[model samples]
Target chain A: MNDYLEIFNLKKVYPSAKGPQTIVQGFNLKLRKGEFVTVIGHSGCGKSTVLMMVAGLSTITDGGIVLAGKELDGPGPDRGIVFQSPSLLPWMTAKENVMLGIEQVFFTAEKEERELIAEYYLTVVGLADSMHKKPGELSQGMRQRVGIARAFALKPKMLLLDEPFGMLDSLTRYELQAVLLELWRKNKITAMMVTHDVDEALYLSDRIVCMTDGPEAGIGDILEVNFPRPRDRKAVMEHPDYYRLRAHLIEFLEVHAHKKKPASTVPAASPAVAVAA
Target chain B: MKETLRKLDFLLLPLLGAAVITGLWYFSSATWAGDLPNPTKTWTESKPYVLDPFGKRGEMDQGILRFTWLSLILVAKGYSIALILGTPIGFFLGLSKTFTKAFDPIIQILRPVSPLAWLPLGMVLFAKVKGVNISEMAALFTIALCSMWPTVLNTAVGVRAIPTDYMNVARVLKLSRWKTLTKVMIPATLPYMFTGFRLSLGIAWLVIVAAEMLTGRPGVGGFLWQQYNALVYEQIILCILTIGLVGFVLDRLMSVVERRFKTA
Candidate 1:
């Protein structure tokens, strides 16, 4: 199948107080229609920067990102983004937050239709009972669920998630992971999620892209997760290959994590050679 | 047992102080002015005023209620007008960084100017209006103008303080301008707006009396000034008390409304 979303030699250089910080260099990605791709790396490996670029929140530096045969421009309803924070409108109820995005996508939708769509998505995210509750009233997990509902209700062609479950507790994280997996399977929407958790990347994604750290970060490796569909958390964890993949990603992370950081002392002339540890 | 005692302890000093002050006032006035009414006499004189401030005594004008109502009306009108104008302006100024920069210096320059300083200008402006007498609108306009700053500043601050992520969510959803204003932005900034409103209203209530003194509007402040000129010491004190009580009640009302709307 033709790649629905393609990144060719994409790079991101952020201008900071000190100098231009190159977040991604020679980074490339190809996404199939309705594919779930998870990218995992240590903190500050440009995982989020990559997602932000794809979502059109940030600009690509060197090359380009194309979606459905068109070059990406700015944020559109066609690409929904869920940040690490809940980012729900605090003044709005869970239902209203979902309706907000739904209305945007279907601008001419009738009031009843909007409400119904909002209700439908809220129920899908298991927030049926708490529809009227605002973000302040709802628990963090519940708020995140509202965020998820709002994103999905828009019915975007692509979903970009940046460390969504990073702040959630272990139990809530696991539960949300299950919900995310279920939604992805049911809808088969193209999703790119950035996570630090190896287990999440292994369980939720069809393929995992591990990113390196910056001044110049790039995709170090891509591992296809050959797990079965409708994966049960316990059963998936008990799979023999699970630990092996987890350890492999961990080793990859460990080696690159330290080497990625600009060394405190002046390094030898060739930084790339020094990175070979 | 200990918690109950601690709570009582919190009330002990203020209560004791109040008692001491009352005792001192009762004794000092009795010693200084032999004809000075004691608390008992003051209470007796005040009974008719309390029961029915409009009840007339022979050759004495019973104008307390009328003055109190007039003062309250001016305060309400001035404060309401300020809220109507200041709220939206503050909200927009708060929402936009450029707008805030454009307007902040003007707001700061105007905010510090005393309301009393504007009274003469207000009287001058309203003096020539065709329909109503200049005196009546002057106090109202002065209170409105003087009390305007707090509401505007607070509303702007509240709007600016809103999390940028929340606005991003609204943008992502492409909420209509009206929905963004009414549903998202206003509700989020309500607590701050109300807090400013409370402060502004208090200022309006405080300033109107003084403004009325200059405008000669039939308010408690004007009445107090009139009674002082006439050497009606009791009436002056009476007007002062009335102003304090009414201001307290207005503040409490705003507080109640604010509490109802405040959410987690």
Candidate 2:
């Protein structure tokens, strides 16, 4: 596959009192044009850090990221991001919040055209009626929808999502995942999302890059998800290989991925022993 | 009927408090403070000013409302200047650590100095300028200088307190520095800035009274001083009441404006 986006040996080292603490090292990935990839790992595994580096929101201490044949530097409008929090400007209405980025990216466009662009994306995200409402007035799910719309409105060469639905309830998460997939299908934008949910990674990504536990986390394994395009939720769950992939992911997380304690460590006492004590 | 009674209680409670204060004042005037005029005597002697608020007998002897209006105009001028100057200083103070470090000590030191102290400096500075009302200029300068600290401090605090999430969004959008300020920083900091403005206006109103008295300008404070000199204690009380009422109204107006901007 053509390397539309390449992250080569990306590393992050934060200085601590003891010494330089390397959170992520030897991290590398490549994405083809219009491909959807998800980085899955436990909490604090530097998955988001890796995504942040790729988006150019965080400084890379070592290595490099090249997107669409251009070397990345500081953040630019070429890469769109959806943060875990909606991050909508509270003062602006949903349409105005979306219009903010649209104005920046499409500066040469007419004012009415920009307004229409904001309106159209907000409408597509199922916020047509509440397009004029501020983020404070909207539900958490609706606010995230606006965030998704804002990212897509930029029409960036790459889309980076840092645990975009990590804060939502399961139902809201499922609904937003559908909304995201629908938008991705239409735009065919090269997208990378960092998530902790196994089912979410399974449903949305073409490939899942799992990271080891942190304090120097690296790619532990990569699983290709070739469940075919235009995937229906029910069909994907019912596929013959679905249980196999699910068990494989669960096993990696439960058994192989966690930091092992030394054999000299003693196990805790039973409930009765604690009560007697 | 119950809701109406609750609404009535809101008005009634304050009225009761005022009546109690008035009763105590009357008792004190009738007993220990024989020189002090009773409320009834004060009302009777000040009736002409109350009845014809805008009446003008001479330049300095105008009706009480005219004096109050003059004070308000002075305060408005000074408050506008304060906001105009203080807001940008506040933005810089909040945005740049170096700027804050260099100037913050000076601002803190200057902020606590009274408006009365600033008056002589203002007079000396305005005395050299040509073709302007010197006393008015000095009064305006003193008022502006005294009132600007709150706006500057609150604005700096507000700008510094902006959410990290918003800044991150600015980064991802690749917003220009100008766009980041206008679209993100300004809007986010507006509520706090208005809080500063409201406080600044209150300070301006407060300083105007003292400034006017020292400047001997045609304002409520000047009228109060003039009444004291003329030995018309009732008129002094009248001027005091007028100043309090106008200050209350100005504060209410500012709070209304502050609420309108606190959309977030």
Candidate 3:
């Protein structure tokens, strides 16, 4: 499959009084159309920095990203992002928050059509009952649900989720994971989610891109998961290779998470490691 | 029973305060400030103006309400002008660091200036214009000049305080400059703007009395000044009380509006 989204030689550097501080260097990734990819690593691994760069919320200091054969410029409705926090407008209702993006993406559509689009997505995210509530009035999980609904309602070519369920409880996280998977299964939009959650990466993504810990973080390893489509939590957990794959992910994280190396000496290892078949 | 007592206390406390203050005033007037009329004497002397607020006898002897109405008109005109001018200046200040850096010192210097000082400048400036009410125009100019700072400062602060997350959302949605401003910036800045407006209106009301006193326009402040010159201290007191009451009411109205915006 041709690459639907390509990020090449990505680098982020911030100037400091001491010297230049390099956060991420020589990062590269490619996603085929409709691929679900999650970048996982320890905290402060610059995973989110990479995601923000792709989302065009952060400036790219070096390298480039090309999505759907178009060189990315800045943030646009073509790319939808769900931030770590819900980031919904506090004054706007849940439906209004979703409609904010929908109105921009579907500018040519009629008002009723836009309303329907917002309503449909909010309902899909299980916010049908509280669609009129503001972010302040909603629970943390429900707020993130609105955020998810907002991103999906845009119907963008790519979705970038920066730990969308990071603030939620485990139960809410599981529920949102189901909601996200259901949406992704239906839409099959190319997605890149940044997370530190191991099981979350395993359950949701086709490929898990792990990064070495930062100040100058790069892709430490890549693991492919080939669990059957429309995966059930019970069946996947019960699968024979589940613990093996889970062990491999945990082991890779433990080895590379705290190990810092100079950027010049680190080789760019080939990342096409199919750990599961 | 406890809740009812608390509610009663709300009304009773202020009434008690009024009574104590009136007693103190009567005592002070009887003792040291002998020229200052007692509360009973003030009410008697100012009764016609208080009871018949809308009466029209002559230009100078018109009802207290007529003078108050005139002062309110000037304040309304000045406050409106202040909002129209100050709101955009505030947005610019909030949006651009360069603009703020250039103008911030100037705003700070001008913000503390009294309406008394502005009144003379207004008179001199409007003195050049043709066929306009010089005193009224000077008074309006002074009120607007003095009152606009709160609105401008508050609005700028409000704009600057918009969450980075909201801006990120705007960028991700690729909203147009206009849409981003109208949808995100304006709504986010509204509560702050109202706070500024509330303060601005308060300042405008405060400035109007001083402005009217200086310009000798027929308003509450002018009435006070006129009564002072005429040796009718009771009517002066009446004007002062009216001004305070009106100011309190205006502030309450602005706060109500501000609260509505905050929750909306």
Candidate 4:
């Protein structure tokens, strides 16, 4: 399952008043099947631009993505997306919102089966009680739960998240992270998440791809976390290597991510950063 | 008890307002040679029309109910025609900039022109459509053409106001254009469309009264004109109440639908 998801030399340029402004350039990543990856960067670092290209929701000015064996031409149900805000249809109940995506993805599935699928995922996200409530009627956390439920119900080949909990409070964020981690472990679906929180990346990802700030941003360093599976956050935090990795990521974000010329990082297999004095 | 009181608050103000208005109306209309009929006088004068409201009392004397129904039918047919034509055109105008650029100016210019002003055009057009001199067709055309503005404009505005994030959600889901329209555009625009509908119905009601008065049609508006010509002040007052009450009911109906869709 190597190269299960391949993003090669991706670039994005927006038409501006002066001229075309590049947002993501030479951005690259590869994921083996079932590996959870998170792209971490500062605001305006084009992490979302990168994830959007993978989701086939944005125009790819220069590069391409190959998911499994198929090239992504445009948006399809193959890639599920969970956005930062609760982007559920305000008019539809949480259950109905999930059902809408499921119906679109599995158009041929029986109505009863689709209802069951929506119910199963909503229940998974602890939203079974609120599933019948509309987006406006639910709390932000409950709304995001519906969003996560909708994406998971699609059962897509890959899930792309655009800081799915960036707006939530820290406590709510932690609760949602646990729910998401449990779901990811159960399904083992290849996923790429965009985030700013270093702890969040370390908590959820098997690999962390840190990115530099962009007019043309690219990957700064790829850090692999080899902590054992069915991991406990408390146990992981107590481990010395976890602190090492955490400090490593924070440094990259502060120094490497902001410095703009992080293209000189060591090879991907080095497992360490060694620059000449 | 608190919930009951809260509900009662809604009706209290309206009832008080109505009572005040009625008191003023009676106090004014009770004066000698005021040339307006008091409520009691109108009720007494309307006893024949009210007792047998649907009666076939000769040609000019078709009862109040029959006249009201005829006027209502004209408004319904004309308003229905307007909705059927206006909504899609408005939606397309909202979605397409070029279409709006070309068509919107004409719509704007035509929108504010009073429904009464369209009488001449309706008369000319319906005098004989393809050599067919149709009775009541002219007034119907005038009513329809005049009242179609609100739904069209409001629907367009509704489409314009849809949040971009919702469209992004639509794209990420890869929903079909049909689904995007039905699931996104229609529901999102429903409240706005209802606003337009209420306005359009009001305009249609106004236009129907004026149109029927001129067309010599057997309706409330025509009846009002006849009673005016015969110097029957009480019947004229009754006609005013009939028109006001019906208009209020029509507006209320639309608002109910609006509230349901909005809060849903």
Candidate 5:
């Protein structure tokens, strides 16, 4: 297969009242077909900003994002993004929300076909019982499940998740991480997840991109998670590499945790040693 | 006992208050001999008028009931017009910031103006409409114009209050503009729009009666004025009671519609 998604020098600079603020710079990554990549960063490392740029929700001030070998334009069906919050439409039932994206993407599909697809995906995400309930009625974890179901229902080539399980309790987050892993495996869909949890990154990703602090933030290091498939959370944590990867990510975050860079470091990628020095 | 009392609370206060007011009116009519007749006499005289205004019962004219019906029709016409026109305008204003910015100031400026101020303009314009006499249309024109503001303002506020995340979902899902407006925006904004509708209905009912009085049209307000001149205190009291009852019913009807939409 092809490189499912390629980000070359992706950057974002937002105009704030104080001055120009750089949110993400020199954000570069490549997702091979069916590969799952998780980006773990401290708060304000621009992890979420990077996801938004890829999703086409936010503009990229410089560089380019290529998805399935085509330069990304505006929002399209090819990229499905689940936000930090579930962000499901409150007025629609959970099933309807999933069906909405499917109907739009697969416009020529008949009504029965659309319903079947929506039902299939909702069951996949473990929301089969919540198909008729509105977002408000669902628990925080359930709502995020609906969001996951909606995103996956579209069958996008690349799934973009911005802290999809961050709001949930520990147990629910674990469950959803497992649910996401299964869905990703079953479909062999490429996904790039932005999260703050180190263990979560190691649990779910093929490669974990550790991000440092920003005004000028980019990947600090990459850890290739070579854990075996159908990964058991209990077994995975016990694996020696899991703790090693977790420790490396924790150390990177602790040193750069919420540190504001001086003006000089706020530009595009300088050498790694430039910041480290 | 506490639960029973809570359930009874909805009906108890209003019914008891109505009875007390009726008792006071009965006593006042029994005591006062001047131009104002007792509540009983007013009711006795007005019963036939309400039931069969056109069918001649006595030599005394049924002009009062006729005027009351005219006012009711005028208010209905005006409020209906307001509902139809204001709802769509409010929906659009609420949905689009561009529309809100362009129209909000104009609505703000016009909304606060007294509906009474529109009376002379209504007379002047209706007089020029040719087929229908200006004098006949004045009450409705004034009522409709006065009632349009609340619906418009309420609708816009509701539209603006839609959660930003909801809008983002609409964008992400690529819902057609038509679908968004119908399935999402309208249903979400219904409560606010109904609030505006109820306010406008009450305002329109009040404004139409007064406008009818001023315009000399056949309605409750005009009938009350005419009855007051005749010095038949009982009939005057009857007309007043009739106007209040009609206005209350009209307000309740609007609220019922609002409630149905709420539950839906």
Candidate 6:
């Protein structure tokens, strides 16, 4: 396949009292199957907007998204999304929430088989004990775990997470990130995430695609991080190439991207290289 | 002693207020030579109803419980009809902005117009049908007609108040229309629906009295009218007390139901 996921000259404009306002323009991206990519940008830089377009949740004023060989008309069962909040139904138990999505995706499957699949994914997210708890009763991290379980149980061809742990504490964020990493390692499904967190993008992503600020934001930089798989947080942080890549991304955000801040002073003369381990 | 006091917290204040009101009524009546029956006279007169609540003597000797139950039964039938018809319309109004924009003005205009205003029309429509008593039918139609608005409007408002995040989740899941309605929309709207329901049931009870009074039927309202016409002030006092107490109980029943049907 030329590209497992392709966004060709994507554009989005929302109509307002001031006439059409363009949020994104000339946004081009491509992803290989099983690639973990994160889009980073300033707030209101249209990263979430672009992700919404990919998830087929928002209308693309122009351009198109092609997944595998087919173009998307609208949202379908093939893409699973996790939002910033857990987004589990307050009225439903975690197990029921997972079952709801899995049952839809595996509509032809027997009821027992779907139930097992739901339970299996919930267990994978370490929510086996709390599977029957409603969203409100569960803590925030547990709720997001259920959200992740619900998304994964659908067995979508790709996973799309829009800052799924943005509202979480750092410890909980790390915990969920590890859980997601384990699931991704086992399933090897393509993943696309949107985050403004530089360390989060670096720790979890194979490639980080950063966008300039909107209105009319588009791709500014694409960095490939080739740290070995089954990576640990401490191990990734200790990698020789990690700091170089981090500094480059931070520089891009501060200088080239909109909303410039006081430059983080870096060692003057370091060889520019992408360490493809 | 503390436990008893805590228990008394539930009963004491309300009981005290009732006693004070009764004392005031007695004091007022003793001082004034008027038709308004005092609390003691009403209690003495309604002793038979309190003692044998299910007694029946046709129009002249019906028990207080029997009259209350008759009104309640009519309320049950009319309220069911209201829910059946009103809930679907409310859902449609909530779901479609165009429909809401078109029909909301008409609803507002008609809502404030008392359901009693429809009595003549109901009389014409429910006129002496085969297998149906015309007066009873008219009373039910009037009560249902009035009671439905609160439910319909409340359900619509509830549906509209649902957080957009839930709808976004629905969209992302690409849930089928039927599934969305059953699983998401109905449950999400339920809390608000209950508020509307409590309000509607109160109004239903309120309108039933007027409906029965107008139709000259077998209910508490009709009994009140009979006592009024007969100039039996003590019996009228008894009927008024019965109506107030029944209305309070109906409201309390709705509160219990609302607590039981929690969304979370």
Superposed Cα deviation of residue A145, candidate 3 (Å): 1.9
Off by over 4 Å in 1: A59-63, A260-277, B1-16, B30-41, B44-48, B55-60
lDDT of 4: 0.84
- Minimal lDDT window, size 10, model 4 chain A: A268-277
C-alpha lDDT of residue A40 in model 1: 81
Residue pairs clashing in model 6 are none
State which candidate, 1 or 2, has the greater lDDT.
2
**DockQ list for all candidates:** 0.40, 0.67, 0.72, 0.56, 0.37, 0.63
Models, CA RMSD each = 5.3, 5.7, 5.2, 6.5, 5.8, 5.6
User: Can you write out model 2's per-residue Cα lDDT over B1-264, one digit (the tens) per residue?
Assistant: 989988899898999999998999899999999878899999999988888899998877888898888888998899899999999999999999999999999888999999899998999998989999989999989989999988999899999999878998898888889989999899989999999998898889889878988999988898888878877888888887887888788889989999999966
Better by lDDT, candidate 6 or 1: 6
- Clash number by candidate, in order: 0, 0, 0, 0, 3, 0
Candidate 5 error regions (>4 Å)? A258-277, B1-34, B50-72, B95-98, B133-136, B249-264
Q: List, residue by residue over A29-79, the lDDT tens digit for candidate 6.
A: 999999999998766667888888998878889999999888987887689
| Worst-scoring 10-residue span by lDDT in model 5 chain A | A268-277
Name the Cα RMSD for model 6: 5.6
Highest DockQ among the candidates is held by which one? Answer: 3
Where does candidate 3 clash, by residue pair? none
Query: How close is every model to the real structure, measured as TM-score?
Result: 0.88, 0.93, 0.94, 0.87, 0.86, 0.93
Q: Candidate 5, clashing residue pairs?
A: B29-B38, B67-B218, B67-B219
List model 1 lDDT by residue over A1-277, tens digit each. Answer: 5799998998788788989877778988999998899988766667777887787766667798899889987667788888788888776788877877787788798999889989988899999999999888999999999888888888888888988887789999999999988887888899999887888998898899988766588898999888788899888899888999899898888778667553333232221221121
Residues B162-196, candidate 5, lDDT per residue (tens digit)? 86666666776677889878767787888888989
| Candidates 2 and 3, the one with greater TM-score | 3
**lDDT per residue (tens digit) for residues A42-108 in model 3:** 6666888898888887788999999999989888988888888788899889998899888888889
Question: Candidate 2 or 3, higher DockQ?
Answer: 3
Q: Order of all candidates by DockQ, from best down to worst?
A: 3, 2, 6, 4, 1, 5
